[model samples]
Target: MIALIGAAVAPGIAILSYFYLRDSLEPEPISMVIRSFIFGMLLVVPIMVLQYIMQNEWNWRDGIVAEVFQSAVVEEFFKWMVIYFTVYKHLEFDEPYDGIVYAVAVSLGFATLENLFYLIINGTNIAIWRAFLPVSSHALFAVWMGYYLGRAKFSKDAKHERLFLWMSITLPIGLHALYNLIFLAVQNWLVVIVPFMLILWWQGLKKVQRAHDFGSKNLSSRPQ
Candidate 1:
């Protein structure tokens, strides 16, 4: 049991560490990051309750509707809500990269608990794939979410702010839906999912770099 829990949690911690370290110029307050994570963990119950209601009330347990609306939309929406409300306007969110930092913290928090639950119920045989797939995917989704959100936060134009904020939710929903769709529709999901993940990772890294660069510039431009 301990081994399974460790296996489930290790990937999320490692991924969070990687993103947390990427904020080269100024890191987010550790307290804020932790608070975001706890908010994320707390999100699971509400999300589960909502999803359960949807699955039962609307009969959305399977098919495209289930993958898109039930799973992807519901999960990403809640994660976005937590980030937006909790730390989006906070003083410590001065750096653009701070968006990624907080988003990843929240996402990995949810992912870690979800992974633990899956491993415990389903046994350890799927632990390896769970790490590679769900855990890593959640981190990547958060990258895109944070990328646009960082832009939103720092932008001067209200239009840009609204646009970026909208993208912060819609983009992740699209990516996440496609990910779940692959699992549902593909016959040999492994082949398709690997390439999909590689693409997401490449794009996610680019967003991380751009946000990091923006943060450095934002810092330098400030009267110090």
Candidate 2:
């Protein structure tokens, strides 16, 4: 039980630490970060309810459509909701990178809980795979969502804000759906998985750099 708990938790913490460090220019308050994570954990309630409704009505037989709906849309939508209602407009969300920090907290919070249940049922042998895949993927999903959320929050131009606001939700949904599509199709896994991981990594890293750059600008502009 202890090992399972650690296995479930370690990935989320590692991912959280990575993003927290990325926002080194101006880290958000620990209280807010913890609050975001707790809110994220609560998101599972709405997600499960929505999935039950969708699955009952649609009945895709666990095919591509159902996979996308259940895994990507359902999960990302809840995570997005948590961010929008909670930290999106917080005063501490002054700089763009703050979005990344909060988003990561939320994502990992959900992911870790999910992991605990999964490992408890499936045993710890697959813990490594769970850590590498689902947990890390949640962070990547947060990266795409967070980058735009941060931009949208600080955006002065309406059009700019609108575009990023749309991106914050839609981009993750689209990418997540795509991943689920290929994940469900696992016949030639590498063909899709390789390219998807590559793109996810490339884009995720680009956002990290952008967030870092924005943080730098904020620091330089502030009065010493």
Candidate 3:
């Protein structure tokens, strides 16, 4: 049991730490970060209830439409709502990288709890893959969402803000949909997911770098 708990939690902490540490300009308060994570874990209940309703309605079947529209859309939408409503306007979200940090906290919170449930039922054998795949993917998705949202929050142009606001939700949905599609449609999904994950990591890293750059510039331009 201890091992299972550790296995489930370790990846989320690692991923969260990686992004949080990157907030070199202004690290968010640990309390806020933990709060975001708890909010993410709380999301599982409502999301599961909604998915259960969809399942009963036959709208969440194991098919393309179900995976994309039902699962991906529902999950990403809720995560987006949490970030937007909860911390997007907080004074602590003062820098670009802070978005990534908070978004990642929420995402990994959800992922870690979900992982714990799966590991409890399936045992620790699959923990490694779960850590590498679903857990990591959630972090990557948060990166994209956070990147655009940070931009939107800080943008001076209304048009750009609107564009990024939409992108914050839409982009993660699309990527998550593709990820779900591959799992449901492909026979040998392992081969495909590897490359897909690599691309996702690359994109996520680039966004992190850009956010960091934006933070650096923001700091430099401040009335220091």
Candidate 4:
């Protein structure tokens, strides 16, 4: 029970951070940001259901190996698809930061739902840690994915645009897979997991700042 509660904290902070950051960006109206968050949250229903089905159907003898690949494919694919199909065309996605905001929102939403389920089944003790770290890590992964995506969407340089597009999709999926692999390998090392998650969050913050800085510069350089 305690663990579950702990786990929930991470996602909560990440979600809140995403909204706060979105508010800081001066590109779109508050309503648009809120709408995106809601949309991102809504996407979790289908993703979770699909993942559940896949996991049950594709059960394997080795838990670690099975979870690492399956979890990555199920989570990353759905989150990316939601951002691409729903939020990408929205007017709110006017700036590069918008991509990161939307992506983080979606990722956090998925984490929230997943966390809730794990907490309920495991109890509050387990929930606590999950709330703080895994959830946040998921958000960080989304931020990394979103940064590149935002760059691709807003970039005028053709080469940069393509590079960003690929990174946007690949980076998050890769990181997510790596995280899963780590969990599979080190299921009991709470100390190590904590530091690793912190590193992921730190990296995410850097990515967000970089995207924001780049966007600001581009916006300023545009002709009046």
> What TM-score do all the candidates reach, one by one?
0.97, 0.92, 0.97, 0.83
Residue lDDT tens for model 2, 1-224: 99889999999998898788767677788899988888887776677777888788767566877878787888998899889988887788889888888998999899888888899999999999888778888899999999999889877799999999999999999988887778777899768777777788888989999988977787688799
Q: List the residue pairs that clash in candidate 1.
A: none
Model 1 lDDT per residue over 1-224, tens place: 78988998899989998998888888777787878878888888889899889999878866888899988999999999989988899899898888899999999999989988898899989988999999999999999999999999999899999999999999999999999999899999999999999999999999999998988888888998
Top candidate when judged by lDDT against the true structure: 3
Deviating ranges (above 4 Å) for candidate 3: none
| Whole-model Cα lDDT of every candidate shown, in order | 0.91, 0.86, 0.92, 0.73
Q: Which ten residues in a row have the lowest lDDT in candidate 2?
A: 57-66
Candidate 4, lDDT over the whole model: 0.73
Candidate 4, residues 1-224, lDDT tens digits: the string is 56555565456655756545554556565565556556656766776666566667666436664565557766787788888887777766777887887787777766776777777787766665676667777788888878888888887888998898788888888888877777777858676677788788788878878888877886788789
Q: Cα-based RMSD of the predictions, in order?
A: 1.0, 1.8, 1.1, 3.3
